[model samples]
Target: MHATTGVGGGLSDEQRIESAAHGLLRDLGRLTRALLRAGEFGLTRSEVSVLDALAAAPLRVTELAAHAGMVQPRVTALLQKLEDRELVTRRRCTTDRRAVETSLTPAGRLLLDQGRQRMATALLSALHTTPIDDCERVVCAAQKSVATLAEAMEPEAT
Candidate 1:
């Protein structure tokens, strides 16, 4: 916890930062919902989840199922649909011929990238009312935010 300001103030430093972060999350949730509404992406949220998982690296059906919180049978069915659409490909793993690895195809990557661009546009539009006033600061902040999030996503060293 941070101490209150020496002068009379409404919120302490910690409280101010916490509130700002919370507001950012809320706005992001709203932005995501707006982008996802009416199925504009032409992909179900579950299908998108699988693609997102594969964007990191090729994974077997079981690994994808675990990452996406779905059962192996369900993931297999979903993978079949994605593969049929040419959004993903499942091929024999190089290290283990018996195992199949699933990866995002070019089409799948394009869809995800477009969605990200749209979301970024929407988020920047929302920030217009804020005091940012310049694109450079916004870009810097966005980069820092992404770097921080990527760091958080990594496994902690033992």
Candidate 2:
């Protein structure tokens, strides 16, 4: 089993930590699902995932495919679709003769902006209407968890 997975029977400290991590992941999943269900924008999950990833930095098709956990051909097809929609643009990579880097267009950025705002407004209103603690704990814990995960996944120094 994976290290994070719990074994059968009684729980160990590792198992408890794993359980908590799983619960946090589930909560995040629920949050994503609810936001998607709100229907503020009609973007597909894959498109949204691509746009969001590109918002961080420009990436070549192969790099983007790796980042999106998809193969090059699939990502290439999606990039072509996004290109046709004017949601993204591709340019020849300056450093490579045979590679292209994909970046978001003004329209794509605007869509992401509006979609983010709509989701934020809906979530803020919902959370405020409830007696929750403003989601600070969840945000902080998730940030810390992601940082630790990044660190753990990094290659060891030679």
Candidate 3:
């Protein structure tokens, strides 16, 4: 098997860091999709995201769209599918009669729980087979990197 490396043999610190970040992002996307499929929930990634957001609290379609990073029309369509499956319900917003609020049903909550358990089992199984020291190092690095990025991304105080 050929090893994948940065464009050039020698790289600066910034280049190496960028390369590693790209590879990590690619692997994370692949692994997340695999884990989602392993759950066998028959839900698309977008659908799962919608469910996850609703698990927090009921929201209007526009709010759900923002939470899911999707457009309102797309959220409405997904909600239709979820409603057909009896996983979610839409009702007129109590505070705003003009707006509709969507919430997860008991079935949706149960499905989400099962999916989470499956994902946890898969992650635990993978972690069990890996070296503990390496896992700890990587986890620590990831945490630090995420925290740094988040801090950098925060808006400046006026």
Candidate 4:
């Protein structure tokens, strides 16, 4: 009757934690690959990321780069492509003519709306493969774990 033994009688706490983490990563990787292949909005991974970021608010090019964790030049290139597709628009910064801010166009919002539905459908289908109670429990625990990790990583109060 070891503390680590489960109903199956052979797993340690360390082993269970490791197994859960590995499974989560594998599931997420598979989910991401499927989403990319579905081409819900005809956007590349980088483009989807940029759009998602901009959905939060309009941002200058530099701010976008920071939020996207990309170099400014790469972000600029992505923005150019998004603009070409009419999914995003850039305007001269009122206070700084040398800089520009970018935001989603109406068309972009439409695209995001459709893309989100497709994504939700795919995610729901995947989750439905698991038991309902298990799915809810796992998702809740994962969200809490993520929040805890974020808090732990934040700079400590002075």
TM-score of each candidate structure, all chains considered together: 0.63, 0.76, 0.74, 0.69
Which is the better candidate, 1 or 4, if ranked by TM-score? 4
> Residue by residue across 76-97, what tens digits does model 3's lDDT show?
9999999999999999998989
Q: For candidate 4, lDDT tens digit of each residue in 20-119?
A: 6777767766767787665477878889889988897888988888767789999999999999999999999989899899999999988887887786
Worst 10 residues of 2 by lDDT: 1-10
Better of 1 and 2 by TM-score: 2
Worst 10 residues of 3 by lDDT: 149-158
Report lDDT per candidate: 0.79, 0.78, 0.83, 0.80
Task: List the candidate 4 regions with Cα displacement exceeding 4 Å.
Answer: 1-27, 129-144, 147-158
Off by over 4 Å in 1: 1-32, 131-158
lDDT of 1 by residue, 6-70 (tens): 54367788877676677776776674577665225688878888988988889999899878879
- The best-first sequence of candidates by lDDT reads 3, 4, 1, 2
Which candidate, 3 or 4, would have the higher TM-score against the true structure? 3
